[model samples]
Target chain A: MNKYWHVVGVGIQNTLVYRVNFLFRACFALIPLMATIYLWRAIFASNADSPQIAGYSLATMTSYYLLATIVDALTAVAEDDWQIAADIKDGRISQFLLKPIDYLAYRLCLFGAGRIIYAAVAALPATLFIVVQRSHFLLPSDGLTLVLFLASTVLTALLQFLMSYTIALLAFWVLEVSTFIFILFAFEYIAGGHLFPLDILPSALANALSYTPFPYQLYFPVSIYLGRIAGDELWRGLLIQSFWVATLFGLARFAWHRGIRRYAAVGG
Target chain B: MNASSHSRAFAGWGLLRRYARLYGALWRNSVVREMGFKTNFVLWIFVEMLWFALQIAFIAVIYQHTDRIATWSKWQVVMLIGASHFIQQVFTAVFLLNCSNLSELVRTGRLDFLLLLPINTRFLVSFRQVDLGAFVNAASAVAVMIYAARQLDLEPGIVQVLAFLALCVAGVLIHYFLMFLLATICFWTVRAQGIVWGYYNLFTVARLPDGAFRPGVFKTVFTLALPMLLVSNVPVKLLVGMLESPLEIALLLGMACVCFVISEAGWRASVRQYTSAGS
Candidate 1:
């Protein structure tokens, strides 16, 4: 546990050294957010007579997207699989295997370091967006909403970390994981509500997604923050998020242990 | 004079045959390479199918809240998605890998070897490798397009089909040029990965209908600066309706000409820079 702190320190140093790359990547968050804002603004403007569609007004939807972008920045992990794949492919994982430090914990610290950097880098753009669109911005209506939101968001970050780690473990068997990574990213954006609010989705699909881990990644936590998931739904969303985190953690551990058996297959 | 005309026609035919042979061998090599990892290929195809399904689901979700996004109806949007998949998957299959690798080649000085060959560097760099999995997705996109057309209860006539095909070809060209432009930027910068990735971030908008976004600066940029809107939107519009306006034709042609000219010019400039730098 104490040794992992050093890993985090190393990751922070590395992140700073590559700050330009990270900031360039973080700026990408603004592009999609603007696109969605313009999209919703159009949809709302064209149907100005309707006060609300699916219980969200233009202002609330805009605010929802703005908040969601920040949450995305906080939740997004570093590109973990490229290094994992390279390590597995080049026999470098063997070096880590001989150490007392666990690979998963090291990755978690690195992910933490990335999250911190991303949050700091993303703050400038997010603040600018908030300032320009401050009129449309909405805050948590009450203290409970804010608390529940924070809890669920932390759970979401953990769940996302586990998910990525599990996916990275697949590199143990394959020569390349780029295709799978592409597929994972596409699904994550759609299902995780990074692209749009899940509530705006069809009730049937939204209800179905409620049972899955995807919505908990971005939408549910943001909804909790926006006070959209009130009372029973808030509690249910939190429970479901915790459930996903636990399951993903276990799954990632299982995958790593199972993946190690193939280390010899890398050909001694 | 008759003999000269015949020989000229034969020379043209011979050039065509040479290109066809080149394409055939490149594709065969790719197919054989993927065959070695048949399971990975199949897995990728499966995952792509799943991604396509998820996109369709997203559209269904959007339509549930409203009848139409703008002028485009639900099935029309689905067609846009299908067309987007078709253009992107086919582009990925045919052009993506080679274009993406251009920057890497520049970095490692490997591009020098290709420049040494008696071939067009653009030609060699543009269509070298194929992702057969993406080829499978392109085929599936046709099925999806047909299904969406059925849902819309519209049978495209020959005119509409021809227009759709032409617009799609134009879309592919624009996409290739944009990517090539990104790749060419590597000549100036040591690390151009961010720009390449930024292009991808911008591309997410291309898959959506033009009507989904409003008449704003962002839309203006997508329309004028990038013209990503023309990639999938115009083709779907043509299939659902017809190319009803002359303006649409001009926009498509303008986008095609602009992107093609700019990317080609940039590539030549980059090559000149590379040679002068003595790389």
Candidate 2:
């Protein structure tokens, strides 16, 4: 356990050394922010006098998107899994196999470390910008709401990690995973509510997505932050997220074992 | 003919043939490779379907709130989305994915081999890796366009269809130039992976409707600084009669030409700066 924490520390230090690269990444994440602002501004302009659409005011929508951007930054995970799969294909996983550390734990540590540093340096500042610029937009009515929002954000990060890692592990079987990943990313933009609120989805599609884990990974957390979900609904959302995390965790383990068996048989 | 004009024409034709050959080979290889991964192909098809579903859901949601978005009706917006996808597919199939890998080629000195080829280096490098799978998406986009046109209950005249196709080609050109202009920066910055990622971020703006940007600084930036609107929006508008002014069509063509010239200059400068990893 201590060793895992030490690995996380090392990862954090390593990321700090490349701080400028991380800043560039944060800036890149802001592209959607610019897009959303333009989108909502147009929405408002079209209606002109209307204060609401689909039960969300322009201010609320703006805040939702702003928080979505911050949530996206905080959930940033390692890109090493695809590289790991490539390395495994090339028989380079042996280097990690020879190490004293557990490979999965090491990856988690590194991801945790990067996320911690990123949250502080990038996510925090971006969130602060949102809070300052759109203070009036937030409807944080109580302390419990704030606490639930924070918890949901943390769970959101873990759920996203599991989902991405699971997809990355598919590379063990797939010739190349870029196309699959691109498609998954496109789905994430819509289903995860990063591009727009899931409430905007058609009733049929919205009901379908509720059964999936994508909404919990992004939409649930931002909804909590925006005071859209409350009381029993908030708890229900968290339970769904927790269930997904556990389910995905089991699937990831299965994938890793099967992938490694294949790797060994192929002489990786 | 003058010697210069004759040589220029000859060189252009030669370059075109060389790129076509290389693109053909890459497309064939990619198809064979993807076919071998049967499971992946099936999964990828499903994923593409899911993407189309998601886009449909977005349109559904927008329509739920209002009868129209900006000056365009729901069907018109859907057509625009289809046009955007078409432009994206064409560019991705030919150039976008290849340009994104420029940094790796530069770092490993594979770029030297490409440079040594007898063909024009820019033409060759830009079109080397063809993603044949994008054809699936392109076909899907065309289907969506037809469906949206049907929903609108309008059959575009032959002249309008031809103009739309021309503008779509111009849109693909603008997209290629923007991507290449950014990719060429790899020559100076060896670690341009972030910049490549940043360039995709610019696509988010391109994906949204042009009218989503109000007439102000945002419009100015999209039109002049990045030209994101001209890539898909204007072309789709022209098809739908939302933009019927002759001047608008002329301006879009002019923008495409200017972007190509700027990107060509940038590519030449970057090539000059390319000191191969090998001696």
Candidate 3:
């Protein structure tokens, strides 16, 4: 446990060293939000006869996107996969195997520490953007919604990390995993409601996506906070999200075990 | 013509031919490298195609509700997005990797070798490698643009096609200049990857209809300051026969020229400030 604490400390220090990079990334990540605002404003204005499009007023729609931005800032896996791939490729995992440390737990600590700093650094700019557009921002409907939103957000972070870790485990088999990572990222960007509200999608398509884990990543939590889900639906979404998280965790463990059987410390 | 003037003209032509030959060699080398990683190439094409498909899906969803986004029809907006993709893909194929690598070169002091070369440093650094995979996506974008043209019931003449190609070249130049300028920030920072990617993110505005940006601070800044909105808007407007005035043409050309001059000057200044890693 103490060793894991040290790992968390090291992660915090490492991230602080690149504080400027994170600041630039956090601020620039808002550029897409600006484009979205202009785009939705145009859409709503053009269809003035229809006050709501797909069951969302302009204000509520903007609020959905704004909440999605914050949710992403809090939960998205930035580049942990690439780092893990490098570790596997360079044989740095040998150090962990030799020690009492579990590599996955070690990584989870680092991820938690990194996310803490990232969320802290990102909160300033994200809060400022929300405040500037406060007229369009919506507060959580109630205390239970806020609590559930937080819980789901935690699950989102875990699911994202587990999925990324599993993908990086491919480094054991393939020389380069960038293409695989990028392909998944492209799907995540579209299906995760990062681009738009999943509800705005056709009911058939949205229902199809609901079965996938992607929407559970960004859309489910934001929707919970917006009070768009309740009672049985909310519980079902959380159950599905947790199911994905648990399944990905098992998959990650299986990959690690199989990969370790074939691991050669040749690079090291 | 005087002998001195004629001699100078001959010397300039010789230099131009030399640079053209050098560029040809670089392209050949890049092609060989890309061929060495054939699977990566194919998968990158797949990745880009998927992204393009999703973007089209987003547009389709919006069009289901409203016939027009602002004053532009559905096909017209598709044309604009397709044109934007084409410009971005072409720029990616030619210059994106080069600009992205500039930071690493600076950080490792590898740029010293390029500085000692006889060729112009900027040209050599900016055009060293080409990603042939991106051209596949560019071709897909052209297919979409043609499909959009068909949907709009317009058959562009040869001159119009030539004009469209000319404007695309200008758009690519603008992208290159802006990215190169951002890349040059590596002289001050250890790595300017985030800032350069920020520029990439900001360029997404190019896909949105120019008319969608109501006249205000956002429109003015993106237009006159960043010049992102003009990169794809003007070319598509010309192709769709919606170009409002000659002023639109002037603005894009003027923006391209201004970016070139500023980036050129900025690169020179940054090179002067660059200190080797050892120093």
Candidate 4:
């Protein structure tokens, strides 16, 4: 337990040491926000119809984007896949294997600690941006909704870590994982609601995506905060997210174990 | 004096030949390296194809909701996206990876070996790797542009196509110079990826119609200062026959030239200040 705490401490300290760089990165994240805003505003202004599209008013739609971005920053998982893949490729995993520490716990704890700092630096400015654009923004007032949103955000991180780690474990089989990472990120960008509100997607497409885990990361949480999903639907969404975390956790473990066996076979 | 000038001209031609050969060799080496990971190569192509498809889907979705994104027809926007892909891929293949790698070189002391080379360091660094996958993606983007033009009932004259191609090259140069400027900051920051990424996202707005962005001062900043908005917009507009101002072409050319000069000067200054991994 103490060792895990120490790892988390190390992560926090490292984030602090590189806080300036992280702060700059947070600022950079705003560029995409600006682009999305510009793109959507164009869509709305030239709408030539009602100010609403697919049941979304311009203000509510813009608010969705703003809140979605904040959720994205909160749930953004640092890519540890590169480090993991390198460790596998170069026999660096042996050090971790020799330790008594649980690898996932160590990785997740360290990652979570760092992101706590990252979310701090990013979320504040994002919230202020929302406040400045308050006319177009909406905030959930109910305590229950905010708690659910927070819970979902943390689970989203866990699920993302597992997803990335599972993909990284493919290094045990593949010669390289760079393409996998790129494709996964691209897929996430669309399905995860980074590009636009998932609610804006075609109803059939939205219904189909409900079965997938991608929306929970950014879409579901943002939706919850906007009170878009309410009552029983919110709890069901939470249930679905938790379901993904459990499933992904299992997949990550299986990959790690299989990867370890193959790695050992090669080492011998 | 006449004989000396002739010899100097010959030396310049010889230098060009040597660098050209060097670039060919670097590309060959890169292709060979990628061949070892054939699956990854194909995957990169597929991944890029998906991204392009999504961009199209995004455009389609918006058009379904409303017509004309700031005076851009759906087909015209598709053509613009295709031009954007071509420019971006060519930039990535030729300069993006190269300049992005600069910070790594600076950190690892490997840049010492590059600097100690007998030829120009910028030339070597700028053409270090050739991404074949990006080249394939670029060809696909050209196909998209041709298809979009056909759908729009537009048959570009040979001269217009030539002009478009030239402007595409200019756009690519602008992109390269801008990226080079960002990467050169590594000499002081030691970590310029954030700056590079920040610039990249800002640059992304260039692919969109200019009318979509905030007008007045903010737009002018991107138009002149960073010049991000002009990179793909000018060439696409020119090709689509939507460009009205001859002055816009002049502006783009001037921007490209100024960016090249500033980037080159900045790179040299950064090199001068570099303490190097040894220091």
| Local distance difference test scores for all models | 0.82, 0.79, 0.91, 0.84
Tens-digit lDDT track for model 4 on B82-201? 998899999888888888888999988789988899989999988898888899999999999999999999888999999999999998999899889989989898888767766667
Candidate 4 clashes between residue pairs 3 or more apart in a chain or in different chains? none
lDDT tens per residue, model 1, B1-279: 999999999999988898788889988999899999987888888888988887788777767777767677778888888998899888889888887787788888888888898767788888789888898899999999999889889977898798888889899889988888988888997577666767677667887778777677878888988998878888887787745686886798798999999999998988888942335
- Of all true interface contacts, what fraction is found in model 2? 0.60
Local accuracy of candidate 3 as per-residue lDDT tens digits, A194-252: 88888888899999998899999898999999898999999988999999999999999
* TM-score computed on alpha carbons, candidate 2: 0.89
Candidate 4 residue spans exceeding 4 A from truth: A265-268, B1-11
Top-down TM-score ranking: 3, 4, 1, 2
Docking class of 1: medium
Residue range A1-268, candidate 1, lDDT tens digits: 7899999999888888667766777677687777778777767766778979789998889988898888888987667666776777777778688889899888889988988987887788789879989989998898878888888878888988888778877888777787777777777888788767887776787788778888888888888887777988677667778888989989998988888986763542
Give the per-residue lDDT of model 2 (tens digit) for A136-220.
3676778888888889888988887877777777767865776667676877788799768988766787899999988998899
Candidate 1 similarity to native, TM-score: 0.91
Q: Estimate each model's TM-score.
A: 0.91, 0.89, 0.98, 0.94
TM-score head-to-head 1 vs 4, winner: 4
Give stretches of model 1 more than 4 Å off: A142-144, A173-187, A201-205, A231-236, A265-268, B1-16, B242-244, B275-279
Give candidate 1's error at residue A42 in angstroms. Answer: 2.5
Candidate 2 — which pairs collide? none
Candidate 1 RMSD to the real structure: 2.9
lDDT of 4 by residue, A1-268 (tens): 8899899898898888777777788777776677777778888888756778888887778888887777667667665778777778877778788888888888888778878888888876787777767888876779888898888888888888888888988988876888888788887888988887787778999899889888987888888888889989988889989999999999999999888887853342
Which candidate model has the greater lDDT, 3 or 4? 3
